[model samples]
Target: MIAIGWVKVSVCFILSSLLVACTPVTPPHTEYDWKLPKGFPSPLVPEDNPMTTAKVVLGKTLFFDTDLSFNQSTSCASCHQPKFSFSEPKKTAVGSTGQKHRRNSQSLVNVAYNSNLTWAHSGLNTIEQQILIPMFSEDPIELGITGHENEVLLRFEKQHYAQLFKDAFEDSQASYDKIVKALASYVRSLTSFASPFDEYAYQNKDGAMTDAAKRGMELFFSEKFECFHCHGGFNFTQSSQHENQRLDLRPFHNTGLYNVDNMGAYPLSDQGLIEVTLQNTDMGKFRAPTLRNVEVSAPYMHDGSLATLDDVIEFYAAGGRGQGINNPLKSPFLTGFELQLAQKQDLIEFLQSLTDHQFLNSNLNYPPVSH
Candidate 1:
């Protein structure tokens, strides 16, 4: 009886051990690693679609995949190339269907810090909302996937995408929502703060910037130039926000880019914020994009009319391009000022110093390697 009782106890112990060993081990949840620079605030991320390594990886793959386009010829990366700080070399973006976009393709660098997503549209506060226009808008036909939503989703049913979607979302279902969320997550991760200026200003790294750049930085922020009034914050734009920011400021500046008929008209087709707000005072008003990586994102301005940074500096020095047109709706800061030839060069040097070489060549921002 004692031997039988001992045998039963041994059997129970073995069963318990086997059960414990066979139990499934849940993998640790991946924490989103934000490699932000010193003094840079945390990017405001959507609560619904939190950042994750798997999601960012999946987003990168999808961003580069031409399958999202109807003709399989263009992807998000087509317009926003990593070589140019996620901004194309074209003055204005050309869509997948060969249609020309009215506005220039804004750079995605530090886009997560932007309170407003696009140039003029104030309603597009989130990346998810802003992405829908590019992917589905028939007016510009960016990706040309308007009516072929199912076809686009069907492309993701392949084994590779299926696995990726499952890993990223913890579900294999490929939906439009999932696509936008993942894409937005990837775009938000396109932060650029490792510039020479950042090193000199925030990192306490001496000799990171040249004397010309340092002088230019002073001029840019000085009351004489008043450049910082619009492009002031750490992101170098007033229309910026971060996780710590209590108030989101979406400021639109009317730089008097145009003043047709002296009525502050900005070419009927591209009337800036007036198109959205229908307010006469809002004419020619557009969000000032971050000056970060401005060296690479040439052909500056909302319309990409300014060919070079030199021209841009001259335009500002002259107050605006509309010399004769007395536009009252222009920003109060548009008071003309004189900048010496050497001072202009210094300003240009300062702008160039903001170029983040590390961000431009980041492997993670590039297309994923094909299997």
Candidate 2:
């Protein structure tokens, strides 16, 4: 599933009220060095599972270890590989036993900032809670840990894991709780802010972006383009929430992907949020993922139906998918746009600038050497 696909520095700090502060800022949790980029706020973390070096190490090891799977055939990296911005090349996810998933596996980049989890769920917010679907859910049987929980857990009782457990939880024992907590910690650590856009925007390095990319950036933020309405903010998404966030904006939109009855109904296999809330208005709705590292994390959209960035652009330019264009549930922002050939290429070049090579290192996917 892991196909080929995918840092810069920034300065400038803002003080409370009117003054500007250049003082070194550190996140409240000190054990883990977030290494956050300048100008970005500290990520909101849950009090129950404070991030730590030991836990991150344990989680990273388990994340890549296929032994964590029921059949030892899959790991978290199977669906989310580091090379593809923590996403995969497959159109959709395939479980350990080759059970096909209903929706596309979204890239996990900057997931810690997401206020909502999954493609449509409004309630599943935390990384710890969302991870349970893969680790234990019997529906699609991702890790297939439901029936074989004890057997799979016992595998981690070895001396190697014993030390890891002890260092992380102050006990030489492993449990589902420890595993979930550690896995969440590792995932929360994945933050990308070294893109050319970051350097140009945050560090004021004008030379960081190409001339065409710069022009495209202007168009992206312009009101006429309206791209920033959903994919806005420092993270390039409206669904983000950081430490300073006060508004609980869990925005989901219907991009008019389907209209089988001319009633804005998406495929029954996966109709987005309507499945959970059972609300008619929520039909064909899905979360707009962060555009960071969007260059590599393709075959896009909730169903992985769009094959390329150009296709996605055309979809938006034409308002929506053919029949769905007239769906009443479609976002008002998707009214359509006139895109010129030159403009399309320029927009793509800007998207390509979002790829962060430094963040795609092997350390996030490969396990450390056994002691």
Candidate 3:
């Protein structure tokens, strides 16, 4: 009886041990490893489309796959190239069907944090919605997927993509909703935070930036330059949001890029946010893009009018371009400021310091197979 009682106690102990061992050591979560820079918070994610490694893999493959296009002539990378930090050198983007877009392709670096997507469209608050314009906008005919969506969907039904879809969505069926979600996940993963500025500012590495760049950084944040008003914070723009910050300012400003009619009016071809809102007060208003990878993604402004960093600096120094200087709707911060030659060089150096080579050189930035 004593031996049997001892055996029962041993069995109970073993069962309890097994139960504890079988339990998860750490809590299970849907959180993704963003590999974000120190002190940088994770980007805000949609509740419906939680990020996962499988989605990233599938989305990355689709981002570069020309098969997603109806004609297979152009892919997302055609406009947003990896070498240029996902923004091409073109003044304006040309669609798959050879239709021309009005605005330049914005860089995708750290785009996940942008409060507003695109330059002037206030309605386009999400990357998933912005992506649809390129895929199916009949007026611009970007990927020309409007009528051929069925055809394009059929192409991804192959075995290779089937497995990817299964892994991403637990279903092997390829649909546009899943495609957009996957692509969004891939774009969200395209972050750049390894720049010299990040080192000096965030990582406390004093020697990362040069003296001139450091001086320029001070000047950039100073009241005299007033650059921080529009282009400020970690991402260097007011139109930014993250995990800790729920501020959806969606700030847009009229930098007086153009004033054709001389009545605070932009050109008839493109009038910025006024067209969307049909409000004259919103004339020439556009979202201020993040300056994270500005050095690599050249040809500045919404129209890509300024060819170089020097030209952009000069444009702001002179107040605006052509008649845009005297425009009534220009931002209050656009008032011309004096920048000496040495100071200009310093500012340029500081802007260049924002380049992130690590993010640019990552193999993940490249297509699965060379395009």
Candidate 4:
């Protein structure tokens, strides 16, 4: 009886120790070595998705892996090439299996800071969620893995990928959510803040920028042109952004790209934000992408309608194609401002100044192939 009583006391002591240890202790916040360039604001990072070196490495591998596609043909780099600032030079991107996409692949530049992704769809919020649409969608199929999900997962279940999956995720088994997380993490790391304009404007270098670029900057910020209304901020993007930011939310705009049939109707082939909301007023409305690296991402606009920076300037100078005739959503601010030939050249130079050559040849290129 005495021995039994001693055993019960020992059990009680162990339980008491475990309870003391289990008392909720707050974990210390990890400090990331974030380097915010001059005039650049801090990027919004979700608390649940903290940045880690291992996560970023895994994300990078997933991003460049073509195995994510239906037939293991096209990777994210297939559409969003690193050379074009993560945008496709083609008006519409071709899928892994030679399927042509309807809309041009949007640039991933500064997308980490964007509040909403895509040209018009508000349904896409997080990069992780957005990656799935292209990976699994059927209508206007992107990666073409709709009916072959099980097959795709099985391919990834190989011993070669087992270690990669285990390292990236907290679980033993690889899943779709873990894939999305890795891709999103890699994309978020595609940050660019070292352009010539960045060195000149924010760094205050006396002669970092050319005289023409300076003139163009003046024109861009001048009240007459009012270019800053939509393209203002450190990132040169309209306000759409995520948390940990001090800026206002971005609003989608219809820059009078079209008024087909003399009515306020955009082409059915590409109906910007109207696709998701199904509202007439939302027709031709698209999120204003950042002008950073704008010069290289030519064939401008969502449809790749504009060909060159000069042509873009001319389009904006004329306030879109319709002008003041039948378009309703045309910004009242754009009143067809007159720019001289010299000023136009200067503006183009300034746009070119935003290009970061280093980013174009980044190591994010496709992995080396084996013989």
lDDT string for model 1 (1-371, tens) is 79976776777778778884433335546467789865567888888888888888788999998899888889898888888888877889999889999989888988888878788987889999999988999988999898998888898888988899998988888999989999999998888889999999889987999999999999998878878877978888884343443332447878877888776677888988888998787888898889999999987898789999999999888888854225777776777789899999999999999999999998444544353
lDDT of 4 by residue, 322-345 (tens): 532357766555566887999999
Question: Model 2, residue 83: displacement in angstroms?
Answer: 0.2
**Could you tally the backbone clashes for each prediction?**
0, 0, 0, 2
Would you list the C-alpha lDDT of every candidate in the order shown? 0.84, 0.84, 0.85, 0.76
RMSD to the native, candidate 1?
Answer: 6.7
**Which stretches of model 4 miss by more than 4 angstroms?**
1-31, 239-250, 322-325, 364-371
Q: Model 3 residue 41 lDDT?
A: 88
Give the alpha carbon lDDT tens digit for every residue of 182-277 in model 3: 999999999888999999998999999999999988888887887777787888888434343343345788887788888899988788888899
- Candidate number with the higher lDDT (2 or 3): 3
Candidate 2 per-residue C-alpha lDDT over 231-346 given as tens digits, one digit per residue, 9 for 90 to 100: 87877878434333333245788998788888788877888888889988888888888999999999899888999999998998899998989988998778989999988888
Model 2 lowest lDDT segment of ten? 1-10
Tell how far residue 136 is off in model 2, in angstroms.
0.7
> TM-score of each candidate?
0.88, 0.88, 0.88, 0.85
The TM-score measured for candidate 2 stands at: 0.88
**What shift in Å separates residue 340 of candidate 3 from its native position after superposition?**
0.9
